[model samples]
Target: MDTDRVRLCFYRLLQLFSTCAAFSLVASLGTGMGAVSHWSMFIWCFCFVITLITFIVQLGEYQPSLPFSGKSFLFTYACLATAFCLSASIMYAITYIQFLPHGPFRDQAAAAAAFSCIACVLYALEGAFLWLLFPETTFYFATIHGLFKLLETSVACIIFAFISNTSLHQHQPALVWCVAVYSICFTLGAVAMLLKLVKFESRLHTFFPHFLLGQTMLSVLLYASALVLWPLYQFNEEFGGQPQRSSDVSCSDELPSTLCIWDQKLTVAILTAINLLIHVADMAYWIHFIFIRSRASAITGL
Candidate 1:
């Protein structure tokens, strides 16, 4: 095929993959824990709407000479891909706590986690081609897109760490303290970056690489290591034992202890397995990106 046709094929592939990812995300999140925060609902709803808009816009028959700017398409897909990946990671991590043991809930959550993994892969594809579609694009939107790419992985690491700490909050309040510190650092870093993005601060630009490399990478690995270590050894006992108050109070029967134990174990297993897949994908992404093209690394030095 000709060059324009090849590019159009990439566009079509992106829209198609993005659409599938969007619908899959909806299904996974809708039947999830069912107690998602309002902000979580809003973020997912926004992702669903935007991906649909992207699909529809790409498929439309009529357009001016330039239907949509390529930069606009890049920005839109970058945003959608980030949203899908971020939200799915959070859902996968958080839903593990809702398990009820021998019932079908753990099974459902596992299935949802699997679907979210699929969606994350698809959105990654969408992000990859956004760059392939325009190899020479640089600055602003390009940097924003790259930042979101990092955000997907870093944010997942943060979620994994935060929840791991939160899971043991009762026993290890000190660990929960780490969550507060990390969250503050992440928030402040994000705000500072946004200001730099707007004001185009040269001084911050010089230090941005250090933040992305040293600070952000270390923090991501910090939580990721904890997540790997925790479930590997301590998933079973993380919930601690039931209270003797149930017997002392009377008129109360605790959940079947065996089944409850099974619930926690299964949920931990599922979450850990999902996390392994994501880390594998991230490693593969790093390798593929570093070897396949130097331009991406030229952007972030990763």
Candidate 2:
């Protein structure tokens, strides 16, 4: 078996594993019991284990090629491995802490804050990689994307801070405000990044249909899913309570609760569909990059 083929196979396997892990995490949210939600944890652990194994195998088998040194590749592998470990550990700790007998809201908020911080770090590293790989052309785009990610994560951090400080569990208005703001910012950033990608395309429009366009589609789907989930979570938080009406309530004074209109089942179904669509788009992008795009690049040496 050729080493290159083996490496490619491992890469594809890793991608599949990552896709499964993402889906598992989203699915776990729908489970009623928190303990039963550990399936997502197991999926994450499995991904890390496979990633380590793949790294070791590829390191031993592959020889250095031009454009980057073996040492640089090893450094990248180390950073990625460390980031994944940190993310998993923090997530597990947060989950475990959330189940404590006298757990405070701050504990849950801390977990989210920690996750957001780590995500920002990972995004920084990823942006650095893109800059290094495509210095002249990709640097500006990478910088813009990284800035947007930082802003997005910062919003999460702010929400976490508020959750930690305030009685967030009881503050329905605050929770709604946080979710709405976060969703809007995320959507706008995603759109900006997509536009950047579109503006960068040259003459390969017909061949690739713009790589960023597919990414934009995925981003829009994700944004829509987030919007749907935001209000649904708010509805869940407010359900079974005396319906709070705003100052603009009509003279009837018998208006139906907003929760009734927010339909959890429909929201969950739409989110799930969007998730599946994003996964499909991800697969298509990966296939196009690995096979068609790369092969064409090699042939044309462009």
Candidate 3:
């Protein structure tokens, strides 16, 4: 089979899996019996499909007559694969440690075990890829991304460890912590990259295609919104945890009890809206890159 054909196959498979997962998640929300369990299973299946497709695509033989060498293409593939695996690993880990055990399904324990094992393998592969493809010019950006991954992976590991020791699953604190750290790191790294792009804007036309530049800008916007949304969600969660007022309290003495709920709901709604926008922008950029832009520059010819 040709490389392009294989790539297309992988892309189609990912699209299908993503669609099914979205549908299953939405459906699970309306079910009363083991909703979390069913949702977790769907997500696990989604991650496994994405990870396997990504790994196969990364390993496919592609011979391009571009200015860049094959090693550059391989490095880019590795970076993308790492990113996919990181996301999959985090989702799998959370589902296993926090959702699966309390699930009513008979196979929940087995599913959790499988997810844990997969997460370990993905973590190892992500680290190896990072070490192999560390860029010289983008050292700061790479370092920040690496640190963020480390923190995220650590949080997953700690949550698993806690679950093992206590035989109880609780992930709110870890989720809040991971999201907070990821938001800060993403904001700083995106800002730094944006500044670099601005400094080199005069030469952008010479070095990059217009479509690619636009796609990069869209990616920046997506990351920025994600960074903002993470903190907003965390703040909402924190505030939502505040103590409730007693009904016996006098009206004059009671501060507006509804205010807290309204504030939390407003923050959550805003974050959700921004997140949806980010996803839309991400999809648009992905389509532009896949169809219109040349693949040569996409993999920075190290």
| The best candidate in terms of TM-score | 1
Candidate 2 positional error at 181, Å: 19
- Model 1's lDDT to the true fold? 0.46
Note the residue pairs that clash in candidate 1.
none
TM-score of each: 0.43, 0.33, 0.33
Q: Report the lDDT of model 3 for residue 93.
A: 40
Winner by lDDT: 1
Which is better, 1 or 3, measured by TM-score? Answer: 1
Q: Let me know the TM-score candidate 1 reaches against the reference structure.
A: 0.43
* Cα lDDT tens digits for candidate 1, 77-98: 5644555556655654454423
lDDT of 2 by residue, 1-302 (tens): 67544544454354435534443443443443233124324434554565556456555765443233433333333333334434444443444334334445435434433543443354345435534544455332334333333334333322332233233233555344544544554455455444434443345544434454454455546555555544454444444322332422321335321212222223333443443344445445445655786688789985
Model 3 vs. true fold: TM: 0.33
Consecutive 10-residue window with the lowest summed lDDT within model 1: 256-265
- lDDT score at residue 24, model 3, on the 0-100 scale: 48
Checking candidate 3 for backbone clashes, the offending pairs are none
lDDT of every model, 2 decimals: 0.46, 0.41, 0.40
